[model samples]
Target: MKVLVLGSGGREHALCWKLAQSPLIEKVFCAPGNAGIAEDAECIPISVNDFEALADFAQKEDIAFTIVGPEDPLAKGIVDFFEDRGLKIFGPSAKAAQIEGSKVFAKKIMAKYGIPTASFEIFDDPQKAIEYVEKKGAPIVVKADGLAAGKGVIVCDTVEEAKEAINKIMVEKAFGEAGNRVVIEECLFGEEASFMILTDGKTLFVLPSSQDHKPLLDGDKGPNTGGMGAYSPAPVVTPELEEKIMKTIMEPLIKGLAQEGIPYKGVLYAGLMIVDGEPYVLEFNCRFGDPECQPLMMRIKSDLAEIIMAALEGKLAEKKLELREEAAVCVVMASKGYPGKYEKGKVIKGLEEVGRMPGVKVFHAGTAKKDGEFVTNGGRVLGVTALGKDIPEAIDKAYEAVEKISWEGVHFRRDIGRKAIKHLPPKVLIFAGSKSDLPIIFKTEEVFQEFLVPYRIVVASSYRNPDKVRSLVKNAEEKGIKVLVAGAGLAAHLAGAIASETILPVIGLPLATGTLGGIDALLSTAQMPPGVPVATVTINGSINAAILAIQMLALSDERLQKRLLKYKKQLAEN
Candidate 1:
């Protein structure tokens, strides 16, 4: 049997290389393959988008199966084209590909199926989009409805930036027809993971979770790119998370697509945000991700040809995919400027020496053999993949290989698996109206310390120091404070004051120090205005206040959520 892989990225190279190792396959071929892919399979000269030509070549060459690598070809109806000619292919049809090809289509499906996703609104008119952004405020996301080669989504921290993104996409048509319509959504916070599965329109074969670094620089700073690097077995996606994603996002989407008569029959990629041990879909891709595929192909121990054939034959339930115990990491080496204009055609060297090392494979993305030397042909040039017993070791090995290769202007993120190395401390803020409330406020601090929830205490009277209170709350919001606790005795209003300044949840503690048995404080804090609400605890309930604040913060924090759950379980047991 002969197999043909479409596209010419590192993903296609990895797929072609893995299929070549299959004993069930007689030969492997890649269309418009890069210089590195040419080393693994027969490189053909055909554009993946030329559906008619591709179908003709597949028939003429007797290619037993064809696998589409990139979302562009799938979005362009490559699967339907091949299938119409009775040619076997692996990928979602164009109708199903719209889930990835159109943000609006994906959002509608998610909304219809009750799939967890960020709340969003679609807009074809640029002015309406700008108006929605203004109403929703800053820290929102702006996205082009159509594909923009992975650079269409803009996470804006300010409304001005979001407005600029809308103008660029819709007004200026920065991404051509892709930006004609737009989808704006609320920005969700948490770690992101790639959840991929092979499905036969019904059954699914889940792959190991992987995380892709989208930013250009280390520490997740700078503009988004196709992908800077990726690693399999992401610690962010625990077993519980995997189950939640399957039940909430992936399964619903597959069933929903089938119910709509699409019956997706290929790899379904769910871009997920794991928030507070809960999963939400960021977007969907109909094909395997690029850098993610590089690492996955390195870690998968099963025969690629057999698995894909089983999925296509609707026998996926009988098959189980095996993975190597070791973790795999892939770091992409690209031209100096990427996800934008950059100089290409720089000579890349040392690939042979790097490939000679154990557990390392260089999958070329944009390179060509010119005069017997590999020269950079696109922004993302090569993916340096490595395997090790653990993520740190895998990252180190991958970097070691990365250091071996060089070009005129090369750049990559230094912190690939750094999130797995250390966890950031959770933070909360406490504001007391008077120094007289310090004793109970100190008790709240003790509770936070016990729970390992870092906190800061401030003395600011809402009525007397309104400016100071507003400024402190604004500062805390800027510092990324997850929740706030406000303590006051007489006519307590600190919580309401703090709540008015920021969107962060606030808890109120009515102190028992003042006269009238603290009734005045309790009632004042409890009866808040219609628009401004405060979660009020009992009189002198500082401990409960701390717990409540932490609970609110844990909504987007996985570690904190676990700790809180354990504490609650202990309470029940006691």
Candidate 2:
């Protein structure tokens, strides 16, 4: 099957790269792609705005389906245009795309559904917007009603700045017609996180959580550009926080859209503000974020074609995306005077050497081949992405690659993913082969609760959802889940599978089930390939699993070690 991706940025390049790797895909093509994308897929010069021309090309080329990378075409009803022409496409309908196209529309949906977001008022008159800002006082947010390529919203610290922002957006038309109206909101203060998910209008599959650095200068001290850099999975958006975002933000938004007669599909990217563990929506993007997508694509282990097909065919509930356990970082290299006046067509160097580095990629957002040499073609030039054991390592690896490649006026952020390095605390995860194993799991949970150890429980079938299990296990270490406990009956290979995914210690609790008197489970749980090991407990020995997990954790935790000794003394006395 041939697939067409729209847009000309790092996001499109990453999409093209991943989609081309699908066995089912005969060819992947990108319309108006950059120099980097040309290496991954055939690049077409058709403008994304020319929907008619694109539809004709897709039909003539026998394109199986199309994936949109940017919000422009989606906002212009490209999905509807293709579907109307009886051609397959992936993206939200124009009405649904309004969530990203118009801030007013998104705010209305949030307000109507009681989805948590900032309180705000809308205004078409420039003076009215300024008046609202003055009344709201400082520390307010002013946003253009329409799309501004990730630069429409301004977080104003003072009333003067707020008024000036209103004037710039509404009076000077800094963002074109998008500034005809403005949204003045009470600023929601917190760390920013980017959460994206794929949906079939009913089923939602989460992509990894990532954080984007938007400001132009280092330490977030400049005007916003498309994006400076990004990393995933964002430590701030913990698993618990991801769940909350799904329940309180993603679910309601999808449900609310359905209620309003819009079946939202494709990617729903929530630009979030997480405050005191609560997630609040700052804005929504109907497409994958550029820098964020680059790193996420590096970590994806699943076939992109399959996931997109599942979403399009309404079979997404049965499919899950698997990503590598390692963390990913993308550092955007821009022209010297980016988010402002900048010259292009300058020669870029060192790309070949950077490409030779393992676990690294340089995705071109703006470049062209001039006499077999790469030259800058746009404001944001390349996205240097790398995979590492954790965020810090990934950050370093990405920057190392960045250092190799340079142009006359290359620019980038120095502190990408800096905020998360100090916050990730190791956690313990318990995996049960099935929900039926909950009885065994409860025993483990009891010990953890008593000892005040932080842990999470997951139920996945190593037989049925093998990819999910592998993904969970592989990602455990980076997600701060340092210890794993697998409980299963029968052949009991779940623990072994978890053990194989990572070097993290795995404790196996064999269940007492079946006709073999639980002996089968005990043996299989104990057995593993050469050098791979599982700390097996006796049949139905869940208490032992919990104690072992805590013991492993206590190796580095002095307080926990003391607590475990006290618990051991009490058990001995009893």
Index of the highest-lDDT prediction: 2
**What are the lDDT figures for the candidates, one per model?**
0.88, 0.90
What is the overall TM-score of model 2 with all chains considered together? 0.75
**Which residue ranges in model 1 land beyond 4 Å of their true spot?**
423-574
Q: Model 2: residues >4 Å from true position, as ranges?
A: 426-574
Error of 2 at 303 (Å): 0.5
TM-score of each: 0.75, 0.75
For candidate 2, lDDT tens digit of each residue in 1-574?
A: 8999999999999999989898999888999897889999999999999999999999999999999999999999999999999998999999999999999999999999999998889999988777777777889888999989888989899999998998899888988999998988888878999999999998999999999999998878989889999999998988899899999999999999999999999999999998888999999999998789998999999999999988999999998788899999999999989888899889999999999999998999999999899999999999999998877568768887999998898999888887675456537888889888898788987787555565778899899999999888878887878689999999999999888888999999999878997799999999887888999998999899989998998898665676777788998999
Counting only residues 3 or more apart in sequence or on different chains, how many pairs clash (N, Cα, C under 3 Å) in candidate 1?
0
Please report how far candidate 1 places residue 387 from its true position, in Å. Answer: 0.2
Each candidate's root-mean-square deviation in Å? 13.6, 15.0
- For 230-299, candidate 1 gives per-residue lDDT tens digits of 9988878878778888888888889998899988889999898878878888999999998899999999
Question: What is the alpha-carbon lDDT of model 2 when measured against the actual structure?
Answer: 0.90
